[model samples]
Target: MSNSARVESPLEHADFAGLAALKINGGVILREAKLLGHLNLRGNANDPDFLKGVKSALDLDLPLAPCSSAQNANTTIMWLSPDEWLVIVDGVTEAAIEGKLRQSLRGHFAVSDISGAQTMLEISGKDCLQLLQKSIGYDLHLDSFPINKVIGTALAKSSAHIRRTGEYNFQLIIRRSFADYIWLWLQQSSKEYGLSVTL
Candidate 1:
């Protein structure tokens, strides 16, 4: 009976249903709880050579400087620290992407694959800013945290990779282990406005 059994996971489409409880407490929210293929790129943001390599690899310029982001349709490059950034994408195309970056940027830079290490939680709606104000310290003003800004900021008792996905849609990319706590915090925060959680 135990010859070579290949078992598939029962959890097919991420945490879509469990988010209902959180959703019921606030405005509509969508959680793209996928193992978002993520990579951390670190180097001199002003280095013209590095930028050239990055442009060649991803077909887009790297988001140099703090609180910046550059995107193509699928890949989003976000600035983390002054010298670090996070590259995010969907689907099962991680190895190819990582390999390309590694091959392209052959210098004093780091390319780390963090796919299994983090999870993405998208919190959007009319109450997105209000909900975020309760958590982070950085000014979430329209002029400050403008559209397409990617910030590595705080989220309640945890850290998150946050980005403005739309006018009202903000995405929170967090670590895997801290998810449960973040989920609880989100539920508590969105209680004032009726939340509709979807995955």
Candidate 2:
């Protein structure tokens, strides 16, 4: 099978061409990021066999509550909507991992490769939450926004699935075409913090 069959991402756009909403060095700039293949998994948590199967295969606990996560060395599982989860794997492991999951699952369940559905933007800094609140509607205060929480909310006049990757770092998951728009928004918001575009 071609590389596209097992895993793929929409970052194939012309270099630094899709980012228009950003200004770096007084011009549009691009910051390259590392993304493993993205996967959307749907299943009910009430099923022990199904849950146990996932744990056995991934070595990561299934997050049973909303806005929660379970992590292993290289994988982080985030709750995405009810009865659904998002799995992130380093490098290219979508295809083989998808198959392994299919074999491990039974009963009502569905999994789809969404590596192409969204591109990742890693926006992080000491003042990342300040910038995040400027871009998103969710309350970014530490009292409200704790670590390891996932939220699908509007960001910078666009919709994105945002996840907190660290205390001051976050991963914004947005559609392919909006890459430039969101990237632009980040720089614009970060300007107050003396923005520095690295790659």
Candidate 3:
């Protein structure tokens, strides 16, 4: 099948088009960073050659520190473990990115395209922080969870790779099967503050 025929994000069946019509002036705005590429990378961060190759290939350094990210216009790399990282890019480019990484990276490294297994949800607004606080036990204060920081944390009964993008904005990397549950949870949790859905 062609790329266009094969591409579909996890929430494509969730009728986001209907939700897009809702006013975005609410206290909580939720939307999917749909169809984006997701790549899981495993390599030695301490190896200078590996780090240099990554930068050369992606134009972004691999963030060695735990729970940190390095990003630019086309890609975002999140640290998942000491030797593992998640690279996100425009959905259509995932295959190409993986191929390039495979060619450029050498010695005890692995890159897998996980775009179909996961999806990203972005939550932002005045109440985004409060809504998050209700879901997880992590301390989200700026003093602790600064912007560009990523965390593997609990959301309701599911798990997500939570990344702080801005003062009141967050990006969640959630499993495809749990997307619906999390969406429902967001709706229920944001009732008081008012939730708006966007594309």
Judged by whole-model lDDT over C-alpha atoms, candidate 1 comes out at 0.77
TM-score (all chains, Cα) for each model: 0.85, 0.82, 0.95
Residue 91 in candidate 2 has what lDDT?
56
Q: Pick the winner on lDDT between candidates 1 and 2.
A: 1
| Model 1 agreement with the true structure over 60-130: per-residue lDDT tens digits | 88876568888898898888887888888764777788888888886789888887777777878888788
CA-lDDT, candidates in order? 0.77, 0.73, 0.91
Q: What is the per-residue lDDT of model 3 for residues 61-110, given as tens digits with 9 covering 90 to 100?
A: 89999899999999999999999999999978999999999889999999
Clashing pairs in 2: 19-180, 21-184, 22-184, 31-199
Q: What is the lDDT of residue 161 in candidate 1?
A: 78
What's the lDDT for residue 199 in model 1?
55
Clashes of each: 8, 4, 0
lDDT of 3 at 47: 95
